[model samples]
Target: MISTVVWGTGNVGRAAIRAVDAHPALKLTAVLVHNPDKVGRDAGQLCGLTHELGITATDDIDAVLAAGPTAVVYAASGDIRPDEALADITRAISAGAVVVTPALYPLYDQRNAPPEFRDPVLAAVADGGGSLFVSGVDPGWGNDVLPLLISGLGTTIDAIRCQEIFDYSTYDQEDSVRYLVGMGQPMDYQPLMLVETVPTMVWGGQIRLMARALGVQLDEIRETSDRRPLDATVSTRTMGEFAAGTQGAVRFEVQGIVQGEPRIVIEHVTRIHPSCAPDWPAPPGGGDGAHRVVIEGRPRIEVTVEATDEGENRSAGGNATAVGRLVGAIDWLVGAEPGLYDALDIPLRPAVGKLGRKQS
Candidate 1:
């Protein structure tokens, strides 16, 4: 049944077209939208998806690739414009489809990309025979595939630290306060603006996919940032309505090394005002919007992930666990393995449902 389209209606392209309109092996088949006031309309009410699935919304990318969809998720516009979004993902993989993207910085850190945009997206997915995968949820699963799947339960690992503290006070205020915490005024300020190189253009490919799955080989990559303010006002019903102390709080740290030794460290903290960390305290049975993973020496491991939601949307628990792991990796990104894959080559199991399920 494959047949999917879903380009961009925003917010992970309307949650990946309501997860391909409630996947049953998938088939929503169209909804492009470059915003001519939301093209033709109902892609389930331009993504409120309350009922109808007649599938509308189009800006005509050759009539939605001649209405022949086998794959195309490209959740457009995260801003950095990786060469005009890899030239629209190489024209939707040369019109044959099969392209999945979360587009925030091409392939994260594909060997410090810029070989004119990673050799033309790896020669347009090998001359568009098709197949491409990129993940989400913080460099696709809290810094590259959950630290290579916790170093496969370790044999003799040394380091890997990933932490993502949340509470953006229910994001969306122009994408969490004017493009992710830049907030108002100051000539659209800049200073570690969400950690320079723009959050490593979205996870510096999770530090080169954890140095190519722990084989470890890296020479350079460094970034650091910290900001605190929001000592008061922060509100969100739909990422707006602020008052208390205005808003401002952002932190990012990414460190990955091999030859010089620091293994990996990725940290992202966003707080538009929410506290608890009287200087590092809540361990030993963590809770309250918790997401933690710490692995250091041999036989030492700790993982605490708790954030679930269903209704009155209090930041719907990190957008339903980052849109249910990017909608269950859309059928293994339509038979993956082309070039560039993260979230540890994608396999957290339970895609359309399961894995902390709650979205009916």
Candidate 2:
């Protein structure tokens, strides 16, 4: 069994702990948390599971790495503190622990990642003979594995489109919703996520990954965005209120152009409230959110994945899928050579031996 450490205990980290506990090939070692109150809590209980996982949570990073974990699941939030996330992940890798995470966006396609982000990670991998892989839902499999797999059914391909349609009203991250996404803010306020070139910085790597897999040369990548205002003031159960004329919905596309035409695209249609954008694409199954792929070809195939957890919370459901992808690869990485890996390098393996396992 690969002894593993789960860092961070927020939205993503909670799911990681549960996943590691359930995986037969993985051994849960330690959990690191930022909240002082969370320290010294049982790992499973901290994540809302009824049974104790026999491991406890701590805030000491030095102690975690000192144990010489075979692998680490770095599930901390990188949205606000990417630099700190990078430093932490690098430190884990430098200590000879294979690390997998959804934190770093650039390293999703580490080959084309900026030198500033990729260089330091490579050095860490070299220094301690450890491996690293960075990916999440949209930049994870939504745009890469799911689309590529669905495209196989097509004969003549025109354009491949991957979409994430989500309703953020029930999403628990209020700061990310109100300020970072400019949801309750005035229409004039541009959220940090939807600003110029920022979409490219985040989702652009997935486009490049898809293009490379299809053996197509991209001329360039481009972006198009649109925002809609709430028709009126809206109150959500989790987030207090969204004033009328405030930013309600956001739609954007990151396009990979081939032969001067956009052949590969990654699009997101996010709404603070369901009533925000009626015209924009919404979730297909009428859930909180979904990751969809549209293959425009002779067959014109489309696939939608709607996952919900923690009482049908789509955000938590999505986080669980990401945790499954990253945690499931620990055994494989433990046996492989120490190096940086990407989505293409990792195969989406099936739950081969988990058929009859008891719930944690």
Candidate 3:
């Protein structure tokens, strides 16, 4: 079994702990946390499991690395503290632990990933013989694997579009929903996520990756967005009190142009309230959320994936899938030569091994 460590204890981190414990080929060794209160807690408690795993959460990074873990699942949020997250991943890789994370945004498509971020990771891998893989939902399987896989079913292809439609009220991330994404904010408030070039910086790589896979040259990448305000005051279960006229919903598209036409598209329909945008595309059966891929071509295929966590929470379910993708890759990364890898380089099938089966 590959001895593994899970770093961070937030949404993704909690999911990682559960995934590592349940996987047959992986051994849960340690959990790392930054919060002092979380230190010394059982990994199970952090993840809401009934029983405890033997592993305890630690703040001492050097101690954990010195213990000789084969892989480290870096689930820490790089959304706000990106520099620190990169440093943490770099340190782990340089200490000889294979690192997989959804944290490093640019590395989602390593080929187009910026040199400043990519260079250090490569040097660290060469120096310490560790491998790295970076991926997540929108830029992860939702675009790279799912879209391409569906396109194969069509006799001919005209356009491929991947969409994430969700209601964010149930999502517990107040910071991201309120501030970063500008939900429940004034109409004039510009979210950091939708700001100029930020979308390109974050998701443009997915466009490039898909175009490369389809053997199409993109003329350019373009971003467009629309926002709506809450019609009336509304209160959510977790994030309470969104006043009327505040930003309630957002829809955006990142398009990849091929031969002067947009052929590869990534779209997001995120709403704080269900009633905010009645006309926008929604999850089937009015479900909380889903990831969809539409191949607008011969046979005209469309696929939707819905996932739920322990409490039927779609947000948690999405996080769990991201965690699975990273954790399940541990064994393969351990066996492979040291290098930085993208979703295009990794196989989707191996990551499904030893999953949802009784542990031996």
Q: Tell me the alpha-carbon RMSD of every candidate.
A: 18.0, 1.2, 1.6
- Model 3 regions more than 4 Å off: 350-360
Whole-model lDDT, model 3: 0.88
Tell me the tens digit of each residue's lDDT in model 1 across 151-260. 78977878787877665555543654555466532333564356457766666677777777777787766778755544445455565644543435556677776678
Residues 146-213, candidate 2: write the lDDT tens digits: 89888889999999999889888988779988888888888888799988898888888888888889
Candidates ranked by lDDT: 2, 3, 1
Task: Residues 1-360, candidate 3: write the lDDT tens digits.
Answer: 898999988888888899999887889999999999999999999988888887889999999999888899998899888889889998999989999999888888898889988999998998888889998754278878889888889999999999999889898779999999999899999999999888887888888989988899999999999999999999999999999999999999999999898899999999998999999999998878889999998989999998898689887888888777777778878888899998778878664555456532
Each prediction's TM-score against the native? 0.32, 0.97, 0.97
- Count the clashes in each prediction: 8, 0, 0
> Which number leads on lDDT?
2
Q: Answer with 2 or 3, whichever has the higher lDDT.
A: 2
In TM-score terms, which candidate is top?
A: 2
The collision pairs in model 2 are none
Q: Model 2 off-target regions past 4 Å? A: none
